[model samples]
Target chain A: MSKEEKRLEILTAAMRIMHQEGFEGFKMEDIAKEAGVGKGTIYEYFESKNDLFLEMLRFSTEQFITGLENSLATGTDLESKISNLSLFGSKFLSSHLNLVNSNISHLSLPEDSKDQIKRYWEHIYKTIESELAKAIEGGEIKPHIDLKMAASVIIGSLNQYAFKKLYGTGLPPEQIDHQAIARMILQGMQK
Target chain B: MSKEEKRLEILTAAMRIMHQEGFEGFKMEDIAKEAGVGKGTIYEYFESKNDLFLEMLRFSTEQFITGLENSLATGTDLESKISNLSLFGSKFLSSHLNLVNSNISHLSLPEDSKDQIKRYWEHIYKTIESELAKAIEGGEIKPHIDLKMAASVIIGSLNQYAFKKLYGTGLPPEQIDHQAIARMILQGMQK
Candidate 1:
């Protein structure tokens, strides 16, 4: 594998370890062993433990965004498009449940992570916001609705619910039906 | 002062330190100094650092819960009650903003601290949920609204927004406009 390919392989292995062992338990030796790489090879890709962990988080986020963009682009109608976005959120968050959970507790984020998180949600909000605005303009939604608050509320609601399912053991994730949740929110925002 | 009074004095000082310097930066000596008590006095009240910290968190949560219950009891009409709840949320979240921000950071939470967080939030959710059901039954809100989701959504949105504000500097706290936010949320949920 090329150097870049090798680096990606290493990160993938590190993420799996993080998922199974928790971030604190993640060690360089474990990643090296999991990746079938020499400890020296791992260093070539990441300078320190913190650096490797942060990079893993960034990579997961990038992958999510890229996948979201591709999924969103596949639909033509507004309903399908919105459904696609929601599905993307559910499935992606469910799969990367650990990393997302770790974002609040395991990762030592840099100053820039704030911008990255805002942009990430802002992108999701803008996408949904544009659709909601269009629907209102098209008379599909109530014209008087405050689109900004609606967008923030919807994004915040689903994101937080999904997060609780993924991170919070207090409530079992199975009890929450995503379609029911989407319907209630969409209905509340409906014309 | 009696031993109990002195202990309460030490806890009050510890809370201030935790609020200002965060839980990680809190030291027994600093709390003792702030409380104007000898270091040995701290040991008389608490068995360990973990015990002291947990007691502080529990104490603050109790105060918050009590204040909210009082607000709920005082408001008679549904709209006024919901409005009071929103305002209460805005005030409570913002007041403890620093301490909450400190706790969510990856390195900040010790493993033992996790259960305390879960219990605290679950209690808050249940309290809100009960009020939500009462509002729905009393015809204060549209009967069709999902009380559980509404409670979760409102709390989650405010929390996330607060989290963003804490991490995303350059945005002054005044920019948040708590009253405006409360109006937006209550208006959206209004019949």
Candidate 2:
């Protein structure tokens, strides 16, 4: 595989290890084994466990962003865009349930990792902000809407459901109706 | 003071110490000083620092619930209810920004403390859930609404703004327009 593909492979393996072992029990040797690569090969790509975990988080975020962007690109109407985003968010959150739980409850993460995670979330918010701006410019959503607050509301609402499921307070991920949620958000944003 | 009043006073002091010193720097002696009680007197009420902190959290949550219940009782219309809730939420979140920040980032909290915190949040969610139910039953909100998800959406949206302000990513608390946010939530929930 190309260098980029190999890096992606390593990150995927790291995420699996993180899911199975959690942060406390995570081991680099396990990651290497999961990646089907030698220990030295894993080290060549990542300096340490922290480095690998951080990169894994970044990689996962990028993948979500890419999926969202693709969905946004295909939808011509505001409703479609919102629906696509919500659906993608639900599926993504469900698949990354362990990561989301760890991110919420794991307190031992280093400061740098925490900052990186915060920045990644900020980037996600910005992406949604731009989408809202486009909707407003197209007269799809109300022009009077507070873009930042609106974005936060959309993301927070969607995330609340994901968090509930992860915390075992809500229905299983398969039972959540993403389309219904998208409709509520769209209704809230309408002029 | 009556025993309950004294407990409230002590909890208020604990909250103040938590706000100013954060969880790590928090000291029982400081709380005692702030509460204007002797160290031994503090032990009379709370068994330990952890117990005091947990009770303080529970007390704060009860206070919030009381405030919300009073407002919900007074509001005649759906709009009034939503407005009152959003306004109260904004002010409460602003004042407790430090507490929220610590709760989100502090990982060293004992498991029982964490469980207590989680239960506090669950209590808050249930309060909102009941309000949503009342709104629906009174024909204030849509009958078809998913009460639990809707409540989560409202709380999560409000919290997102608070989180952003705490993180310095959004407007200061005083500058946020709670009415606008309330309007958005009300609009979304309306039939």
Candidate 3:
């Protein structure tokens, strides 16, 4: 098999194992066995188990960003762009709840790894920020609204909802009725 | 000292140590030393480390609930009551960001312990729900607004914002301006 394809296969297997067994429980030997690769073969691609797991997260997030950018590019107006983005986010969140939950959000990491995660988050936020700025410029939203705070609120609220789904069970997720929640947040509940 | 006073002192010391070093780093020996009690005396007060830690959370949250209830009781109108409750919530969240960051929201405990936490949260929500219901009945809110969803949205959104604060660096929180956020949520940004 091609090296790139083999690497992808290993990553997929790693994610599955990590999701089921958690970060601390994951072992490189088990992953190699699960992926049908020689133990040394994993070392050829990744320096350590930490690298393999984090790279999997990076790969998934990069794909998500690319999908988001493509979706946003299709819409002209800020409203439609944001609408599409939030819908995409909702579906993405529901589909990858396991990945999101598996992210060791609390664990301390090596400096370089920590920086990579920070940059990834910053890039995503900047993309959202620009969209918000466009909406404000287009007069779709109130002129004086703090775009940063609004963006933070939007991102924070949705992420929190997703976090709640991961940790607890209550609110029906976006997959069940995307339009209802999208509508509720976009337009305040007041009459 | 009296039994209740000694128990209170132990819990206070436990909280201080846990907040500084986290649950994993929270050693029984340190707690006993901080509380000025023999290691065995800790068992006299609480059966185990997990039991002591969970009680620490319950003690703080109960104090928070009592403070909020006092604020709510002072107001007659639904809007005023909600406003007071929401403000108290924002303040409480800012103070307890670390506790939430530690995943206290999703803490897994034994059945009775879990039930105690659940009852505490339910009671908090129940207070707000009934107050909102009364407001709807009194026509304080718009006649058509869904009080249940509205209550959830308010509580959920505020808690979500507080959770976000723990994830990223921002203005030193003193300048976070929850008052302004409360204003926007209660009254829209629209002119």
lDDT of 3 by residue, A62-131 (tens): 8778867875787775545645665666566544423432123434456677667767766876887787
lDDT tens per residue, model 2, B110-148? 677767777766766787778777777777777877766
DockQ, model 2, C-alpha based: 0.25
Best by DockQ: 1
Candidate 3: residue B35 Cα off by (Å): 3.6
Q: Which candidate is the best by lDDT?
A: 2
Candidate 2: regions farther than 4 A off: A1-3, A36-41, A97-122, A165-174, A189-191, B1-122, B168-170, B189-191
Q: In model 3, what are the clashing residue pairs, if there are any?
A: none
- What is every candidate's C-alpha DockQ against the true complex, given to 2 decimals? 0.27, 0.25, 0.23
Question: What ranking emerges by DockQ with the best candidate at the front?
Answer: 1, 2, 3
Off by over 4 Å in 1: A21-23, A33-40, A67-87, A97-124, A143-147, A164-175, A189-191, B1-53, B74-83, B95-117, B164-191
Model 3, chain B: what is the TM-score?
A: 0.79
Name the docking class for model 2.
Answer: acceptable
Measured with C-alpha atoms, the lDDT of residue A154 in candidate 1 is 56
lDDT of 1 by residue, B1-191 (tens): 88888878988899877655543457888998899989997888999876787777777777777866776787775445545655565566555523332224233346677667667767776887788677767665567666566765666555545444444433444555454444455554223
Instruction: Assess candidate 2 and give its TM-score to the true structure.
Output: 0.68
